[model samples]
Target: MCGIVGAIGSRNIVPVLTEGLKRLEYRGYDSCGVAVLKDGALQRARSTSRVAELQEQVQADGLGANLGIAHTRWATHGAPAVHNAHPHFSHGPGAEAPNTKPGHIALVHNGIIENHEELRAELQALGYLFLSQTDTEVIAHLVDHLYEGDLFAAVKAATLRLTGAYAIAVFCAHEPQRVVGARHGSPLVMGVGGVDAGERFLASDAMALAGVTDQIVYLEEGDVVDLQPGRHWIEQAQAGEGGAVAHVRISEAQRPVRTVTAHSGAVELGPYRHYMQKEIFEQPRAIADTLEGVEAITPTLFGTQAEQVFSQIDRVLILACGTSYYSGSTAKYWLESIAKIPCNVEIASEYRYRDSVPDARTLVVTISQSGETADTIAALKHARSLGMEHTLTICNVATSAMVRECKLAYVTRAGVEIGVASTKAFTTQLAGLFLLTLTLAKLRGHLNAEAEASYLKQLRHLPAALQAVLALEPQVVAWAEAFARKDNALFLGRGLHYPIGLEGALKLKEISYIHAEAYPAGELKHGPLALVTAEMPVVVVAPNDVLLEKLKSNMQEVKARGGELYVCADGDTHIHAEPGIHVIRMPEHYGALSPILHVVPLQLLAYHTACAKGTDVDKPRNLAKSVTVE
Candidate 1:
């Protein structure tokens, strides 16, 4: 993942880029850099540190430029270093000294260049020189090699040749007044700004354009825009000779700045040191926003274009990466039990490599918070190639590739997840997936009138139901202390709780540095019981539902082995309040809507346990917020 921004029509651009980078930094913070066109040449400055540090250096040097492209990189192709940072120079694969012009062209890129090695080899054979070892260097050389004196056309041609996910911003010496930008399977946004009576702004995401411009246009895949003084034009990006360009002009009054309120966990003053804590407090609002537009279904739940496909689909295949894959696993239970549909949940990275049986009638549901997960996008493309016309995405980032590729999109309004561990994104995705399940069940007529009415009532009541769950935080904190001295744990659930159990274990293991395992309440005897000891804590999800009795029995199994039990239970007096076991009361029943409520306790447990360990809860050790690069 990387953050990219460009400005051509404003005051000193370095400052604007700096501010924009701060907002976009959540996308990438491994390294930062800027490419500014000045005095008929391109000048570059960069850093292998945070944007705050780099901005300090840029200010100290008194660097000033009106138009430029800047970047904050999350290293994927190269190590984190100054030379490996963004704003990479494009001399050639091995260029000697032919194009040593100071400001010929400068650019920054996000996403991967799958054909980089091949392009580098060809350029090396042509005697093009290289600097740092990064796939982004190919964009620089591609721009230089395709320069036709017009920066926009050259950038467009370069994009046409390149294959894979990329959103790039470019500037050229010949066209110092403009910043040309393009996107292909990667996120990009064009912000309309009022700049000294003339100019344009382009950034990788809306956050970069937040204060600069309120009116922003999300660039579609295969689209390139020509940034000019006081005006800009968009050429529908085409691969070959037979292509058409669509010209659309935008005014500056549209892009408005989002005024974020000073929430309890938003700012880093002192107490809760990390942003992840701040974001945790914002979860309630985020969850509400995710349900805002989704509640109002249009003429068709899956959209008009996909209506016919949706009506014909017999099964569903959900492909995703990481946390979203877990969300898909949870959805599989809902779809199979509630919607009565046969569904498959596959990790996108693995799905693409395996042969499978899917066709026009088999709907493919892809889930992603960023919607830019490399394998997920590839899997979507693979399914589309196989004539699977019915497709949808449960996603957070609306500008991501999955949103553009999928026939139907369910957008999760969990805005700007900075922490790499994924907190609100996962919970909100579950909400979206749940809604999708309801929609599909209704569409297939499997949810009978009585069942549909109950589902709707539950859906409408979920937001408040989630609030009830959040109220259990104090109890969760008390329970986390039980595991203060333990290093390994086990999570148990039955039926639908099985997925929640897995998710709980994943959250604990991912950031808490604990080894945790989850199993169906009955499956513990199959194998996992051997690992349980007094030193190992076993967490039993005791939601007061049909499976509560079964889960309680499993808790006894842990206790029989002298394993400490932390039972997350509801006020079910039937739960055998055994000795050497801790009970944290969960929210009351919400029928099938329990998953949403079940997660809040686990989140609190994970958060407080990590706090007790004095770990870096937000940044962790080596994780990036979005996996923008493959």
Candidate 2:
């Protein structure tokens, strides 16, 4: 995944493009570049550094243009060098070079082109030379060959020959007044900026449009957009009714552009050194916002139709990816134990590739923060195709595609999560899923009035409880000093807490770049115990549940092997800080909600460890904030 931004206006758009790229840097950070239509040609600057360096280059070169496109790349096709950065142009030192001026359609792209090899061969036959080893370069050359003095027509023709997920922004020196954008499986949004006769801005995320414009338009799949100074139009390829073999027809339409006043204030990094640290500390407010007006647990907490859907369903199927998948796995323990519903969790990317029996009575639940994850959306559609129509989602963005596609939704009010490793979003998702579990329990008659009230009381007290857990950050920073020196670590838990261990390990590996693994305590003696040594740090999640003594023995096995143990035990667990074992006592036993509290220290541990290791905690290497491409 990469980040793309384009703007067309009367003002010089170099600062606009650079600011948009700065906000979108979470999507990609390997390299960044900007191209502007200036002085009858395209002036471009590329850097193998961060967006800030690219901005400095733009200012130092004094590159100015009325319209431009910028990109921040997460290298998929080539190395992270200046030569491989975007925005890419079509001219190179070969037959493709017609001795023309610069800027023969400069383009910035987001997703992968699966058919680039075939397209490159065809373009080479036309005597077009390629400069960079990126699929986006092929697109620039193709658009250059097809241009008939109309930039939008040339872009539309080029996309018809391409296959795979992409969100691209194209600009031409010949048509410096306009910029064209197209999307297939990736995300792209349009915004209206400026005061009188506003400018048009396009980006991969709304956060990029913050403080510039609150009026936003989310593009749909297969939508091609043509943007000018104060106007825009859209075109879609309409297909005849023959399914995949249908004849395709082109149709153009224009709607009154609706503007949504986005909450841009959430994007600010207030009083924190890094966005990851700020989000980790914002957990109390995040959880409080998610459970603000909940007085009781009922099926209606999800939606009005939730009761009807739950009554007809006997099994639950959860589809998700990455951190969301681990949240779904945690919900499995609660869904089955409390709700008495048989539940299964599937990795969204793998679920659609295999043949499996689907039941009509199964409730399919999709979990995502952006709600634009391509694999999860495809998996949800596949389940629907197999006769499972009852669908729901626990998503953070209310306007995201997953929320629109599902029949019912629970939008988590975690605000905007910008860090690559999710913090507030994950905990808010657990809170939402816990609410789902309680609702299903009540519907199945598994939870009586007294039991429901008790769970509600615990739910209402979660914000304060999370606040107390955050006070343990100083001690977690102490443990992180030891972890910062280790090359590898093991995370251990059992029962409901095993999924929490998995999540903890994921956070550590994602942000800190540490090699980490998680195993159920019972599985330690089987194979993983051999990797235990004095240099290997073992992090344990031991809540005061039924598995406390069992987890203690697992801790003993690691200590016997000369491994340093870091435990986040409950207050009553009796685990003390010793010579070989380090303990951070939790405030209280959280019962079924222990995973929510136990994960806070793990996040702090990763953040502080990455800080000590001198790693980028906000944007880790080779990782993007959203997996928009499969």
By TM-score, who's the top model here? 2
What would the per-residue lDDT of candidate 2 be over residues 430-517, giving only the tens digit for each residue? 9999999998988888899999899989988999999999999899999998899988999999998998899999999998899999
- Which residue runs does candidate 2 get wrong by more than 4 Å? 92-103, 241-256, 263-268
Q: Which pairs of residues collide in candidate 2?
A: none
Return the number of clashes found in candidate 2: 0
Task: Give the winner by lDDT.
Answer: 2
lDDT per residue as tens, model 1, 1-630 = 688889886578788888788876655467898878777777777987778888888887777788988998887787888989989776743345544644366888888899999988887776667777888887888788888788877887787678888988888778767788888777777766645546578877666766566656777777777777777777665334456443333333332333322111123435555666655656778888887755443325546676676678889999988778878888899999877899999988888888887667788999888777877888889988888878898888775668878888878888777766677888888878777777777777766777766666776676677777777778888877776668898899887778888888877876687888888989999999999888888888777787766776777788899988887777653564568788776658766767777767787777788888888777554566667666
TM-score, predicted candidate 1 vs. hidden true structure: 0.87
C-alpha root-mean-square deviation, candidate 1: 4.4
